[model samples]
Target: MADLGHSSDDTSVDSREENSSQDSKPEFSEDEETLISRMYNLVGQRWSLIAGRIPGRTAEEIEKYWTSRYSTTTE
Candidate 1:
């Protein structure tokens, strides 16, 4: 068998750990949600700026929220 440069056991374990961690992703509080909306309106997708205003949140998280909350579904 050819080595695929990756181990199946390690990959499965890593993915399981990541999935568990993500399953407990913290929710955005009402105030944080409001702040994100206002910031997005003012900054126009500047996620880092929004994240800076909200403590304990990251730019990627803000962006994901915005996308999920506001983005229209296109088939």
Candidate 2:
């Protein structure tokens, strides 16, 4: 028999880490914001399309960002 690097603690801890990561919000840099704005003007509100240009970003997150950043009344 061999240890094979197996451990009960590994599986249990990994599941918790995955769940916590999903709950965390995405972070964007200043450069990313500028790029997003430029891309929006060029491509319009196609979130999935826009997301494809920005690596590691999803359509859902981009939509949320667009709404919060540019879709508000801001009165």
Candidate 3:
């Protein structure tokens, strides 16, 4: 009989929980925000390029944070 009461991927779940427990969100500074904004103005919607201009943030993270705070489209 299958053990439907528990997932077969219990180890995966446990590792995910452990990793999540150790993970911390990066603290973006006002200066970094200002730089991101300025880069947006100069480059428009280009997240990777903007991230290259800034430090300590991936393009995906920058895009997510920027889009969350500012709803306006880069177009």
Candidate 4:
């Protein structure tokens, strides 16, 4: 038979390595949670103006948090 590109075992090993790396990363702290909450509350309603109040918060972070919260609440 012709050789396959990769075996199932190789895929399993790659998945495990990726999960292990993700697990090692630091979790967000309470301050981060608060910032994310505030950001989500301000998204779209007042993006440019509210952003000035939160110095370190990013637009992407605000969007993600708002999306996550919206999904959770709708479900």
Most TM-score-accurate candidate: 1
Which pairs, if any, clash in model 3? none
Model 4 reaches what TM-score against the true structure?
A: 0.33
1-75 per-residue lDDT for model 4 (tens digits): 223546766788999877854553323457765765676465644544444555665455445544554555642
Off by over 4 Å in 2: 1-25
In the range 1-75, model 1's lDDT, one tens digit per residue, is: 335545777788899878854853447899999999998889998999999999888898888888877889998
Per-residue alpha-carbon lDDT of candidate 2 for residues 30-61, written as tens digits (9 for 90 to 100): 98788889989999998999899889888988
State the weakest 10-residue window (summed lDDT) of model 2.
Answer: 1-10
lDDT of 3 by residue, 23-57 (tens): 44434689988998999999988999988977667
Candidate number with greatest lDDT: 1
In candidate 2 the C-alpha lDDT for residue 30 amounts to 91
**Candidate 1: misplaced stretches above 4 Å?**
1-21, 24-26
Least lDDT summed over 10 consecutive residues: which range in candidate 3?
A: 19-28
Instruction: Report the poorest 10 consecutive residues by lDDT, candidate 1.
Output: 1-10
lDDT on C-alpha atoms for all candidate structures: 0.83, 0.79, 0.78, 0.56
Task: Estimate the overall C-alpha local distance difference test score of candidate 2.
Answer: 0.79
Query: Ten-residue segment with the worst summed lDDT in candidate 4?
Result: 20-29
